[model samples]
Target: MMASNPAILPGDVAREIIAPESYAAWDPLLDTFDHLRDTMPVAKVVAEDDVFEPFWLITRYDDVMRISKDNKTFLNNPKPVVFATREATEFARAATGSNMLVDSLVVFDAPIHPKYRKLTQDWFMPRNLKLIEGEIRALADKLVQAMIDAGPDVDFVKHVAAPMPLHVIMQILGIPEEDEPRMLMLTQQMFGGQDADLSGSGMENMTPEQVLELVSGAVKNFEEYFAGIAAERRANPTDDVASVIANATVDGEPLPDRDMAGYYIIMAAAGHDTTSATMSGAMLALARDPEQFARVQADRSLLPGLVEEAIRWTTAVQHFMRTAAQDVEIGGQQIKKGDWLMLNYVAANHDPAQFEQARSFDASRSPNRHMAFGAGAHQCLGLHLARLQIRILFEALLDRIDSVELAGDPVRSSSTFVGGLKTLPLRFASQ
Candidate 1:
């Protein structure tokens, strides 16, 4: 049963929730979420111009966690897993006959999702990741040395954070070093297309359809490029994750072409970007607070906490959409069947109810149950890898750098999806 009248967000606020530009101006967006959490935590967001579909915005920590953990009640399919404009939704449906352009683990439900996820599940586990520890550390050292050589002033995001995880994940996928730039560009266009600086495609001036077309083109390029890699791995199987996916069997049969491509795309794009974002955020936080930076540097044991706090503080993947399977009561409101919901991770991670001094980054914060990597079945598969990458990179950074401070204003990516500091200028001295 529905309520006589569901709460609706004001037009300006609703627009801010969906506007990509709002995310770049980070503090203001958090202020918006703070206001929403106090007044209308679960209000409905209807686009003023009807450009996008209407959905309930879940702003509280408990509500977002509940929805994230209950994948069945909150279905990922039959709707776009990520929010899409009406035009973009139709464009995806007409092209792929699905609500999303990329049909990866995030877009799957039930039986299929678990089956697909198990293919490389062990490989991402901490124990299995130990096999690549040296490789990751070496990459970290090289990047950190490059940062030192380029110091006392450098763009940490450009020189260190961005390339460390990108190189590591590329190696895990058996991608040659030469082809990494192409992969990076495609990933930016796919996830950061809303930002002109990231996409470099002038997407801010483009219509939704035009922006989507650019994203689709990036997907096509990825498929074509990975298609050849898949062929090579199939004929000559190796120990890499790419080979595992290429030769994986769901039900005693090889995976379909689309599913295989989807698997590769997710690994190639997500495996790196989210980790990079967290790394950049951690550095930015350390730069801003020299005491915290010195504390972690002097006490190596605090590295893990720093990594975890960074993930929570940055919350790179801001929000994800989930559709209701049936009518239900949540947050003192009735959610009807098939209603779309936005699990705003940014809000959940920053909720005062869940975290003390939610706005501030505290490495020592215990019981840190953040939804940055999400939860339940669709929780990020590479979470352990992400943690490992950040820990090792920061370890190298702390060992090499004696002190660090901000050189200029940091710039966040204008992406409502996966985003972090795109530019982190810092002045540092070598130990």
Candidate 2:
């Protein structure tokens, strides 16, 4: 076990916090982090049984901010950004001949990341998104109506939050409506496999090897499906994201099939999972604090605050892993070259030094520059679209929903990397 003292104690804590099966047990890690922030902000996280490398877990807001912004020093290229279990890492590397986690845009450094990001940069800008604002608003309205039709008591996660972004992203990508269910299913298998219901493979009781087997099967299905889609886009192009991906080039050359597959997978899966989690987190916060909900409902102007607060509060996309290119010092701690460090975004988002009342969910949090979408070059490409989607969806909900209450038990996804509520049951009264 890692050090039994200081920041993180040796126990089931690492498993509970970083493992997929224990994602539902949230507050323990948060509480431990609250202590770590003060005691040892950048402490080594040794896993149980030495199954994973001991990573420097940076929890303080300032340190995380510094590391994320200093892309030149704390590079994202040449490695995976999200820490994988050693077993999964070995299996993926063996199967793919390269680390599967090391392929995506988020895992690349300058020159490459910049070039790849530029391909679809203009498409996500506010002006471009403005063109789709009406369409999005209409979709949001339709989604809210669907929720209302589901009756007063609905699992908001299923009825409202989960489906809205999936439909929107699939539309933008020009995927068929019939395929939406399949896409969502694959997304759950990819991101929420830690949970029993979401994984579809009963990950709640599976060994790490079994879990990877499930993930491998899902990845195979996604690759086959997207390959067919890419070919179609090639044969008959359209003004959609899939078409954009199919036609994109870097350095006057086409992206390799594997990289292209990773891009599509990230967009399709991360797009919905992260957004849905944030939406559920926001709704959960609002549900818990009716006064805040009433304030936002009464004043539409507060919608942005609500959205930002939700992003910060949820911190859906948790930690990003960075490997040291050379020896460096961060937060007054020495980091050796080739070392793995976890920029724990959730911990950073709630750092007391950066945010006042960081533990409390304040809808009116001013100067809220949380690193929920990350910082610098690798900042989330879909951030604008995410914000636009959330704001529009909330606008629709505020117009129709007058009040909400917890209908039943709410459950968080059992995913260490992308954590949020999987089942958010709620009862709301319509306006």
Candidate 3:
């Protein structure tokens, strides 16, 4: 769009940016980002194999923030909202007849986005979330007790982090308790398919085509499951979020089948997975820093800071793609119309320019304006719920455990998209 040949990222760096394994090795990825932000903050990434389309990688904090807030200039549609290979993109288009595999709020822009978001926006706000506080706290306590009962040593991610938020969101959606495991499995396959351990699908040994097939299968499974829920809610409406979506209207007409399925899938999957990742991250950080954990345990007020810092520290949703609607200058680089850009949250959140001592897990960082929940109209709808879940879980955890330390080396999920600790082995002493 700009020139016949634009400056391309170095092969090694470009590979690292797109590689799923790179995200699991967190420090090195951050180091790569640090180097990029210092030298070429806005670099074009073109895969060596040409598996994926070229997109401008935005690593600097200010530039990412500007692009995120300026959704008007950077539209989410007509391109995959998340990074996808050319093959995967084609598969999605062929399957759904749309740019995305799922046409949810994350992939919409402008006139349609606001309408869909408003349907459940009030339900996710702080005041409304407060109505569910008791329920969430009770669930947190139950999970924390179970963790304590099994601990002295336990995998925190398995015992506590993963299930607590899942249960809460499921309850809110009016899903039966028996179906949560199915939901969790589908979510992992959808978002964690790159990681063999998480997906349980031997993805490491699979070809790209095989991996795409596995993910598409997961999406199909989700749609089929939600279809039943939507039908039931339509027939017998309830106060749950599912009923809200089932009966919602756009321009006085019911949501089309695809949109309805997309809505349910995003809510059911994203509602807990991101929160689970952040919770595990917070526990991992505190387990590593005994002093910080002790300080938060003593001062209940610091729990808020701990939660906020963990969201910034983990940045579960690693990156989201945006398409340029018009020619513009960003971070001293000219972006041409229709060009794709990656808003790398992990890079921006860890940028030393924005956060002093960026790598350190400091719970007391005032004005921790991190891009974890993103910004502007597309900001995560489940943010308030995420924060609340983390706070309550930690509150219950600290109340029951006198001390906590790593029992073994933690393992992170190898995913370029939503990812965090998949295994967090910890030893704790009961209070």
All models: lDDT? 0.92, 0.84, 0.93
Evaluate residue 319 in candidate 3 and report its C-alpha lDDT on the 0 to 100 scale: 97
lDDT of 2 by residue, 100-126 (tens): 532677867887888878878898899
The digit string of per-residue lDDT tens for model 3 on 1-431 reads: 23444556899999999889999999999999999999888899988778889999999999999999998899999799999989999999999998878899999998999999999999999999999999999988998888888878999989999999899999989999999999999999999999999899888799989998999999999999999999999999999999999999999999999999999999999999999999999999999999998999999989999999999999999999999999998876789999999999999999999999999999999889999999999999999999999999999988988889999999998999998999999999998
Model 1, stretches more than 4 Å misplaced?
1-3
lDDT, candidate 3, at 384: 92
Model 3 lDDT, residue 353, Cα: 92
Off-target runs (Cα >4 Å) in candidate 2 are: 1-16
- Model 3 weakest 10-residue run by lDDT: 1-10
After TM-score superposition, the amount by which residue 92's alpha carbon in candidate 1 deviates from its true location, in angstroms, is 0.6
User: Clash number for every model?
Assistant: 0, 2, 0
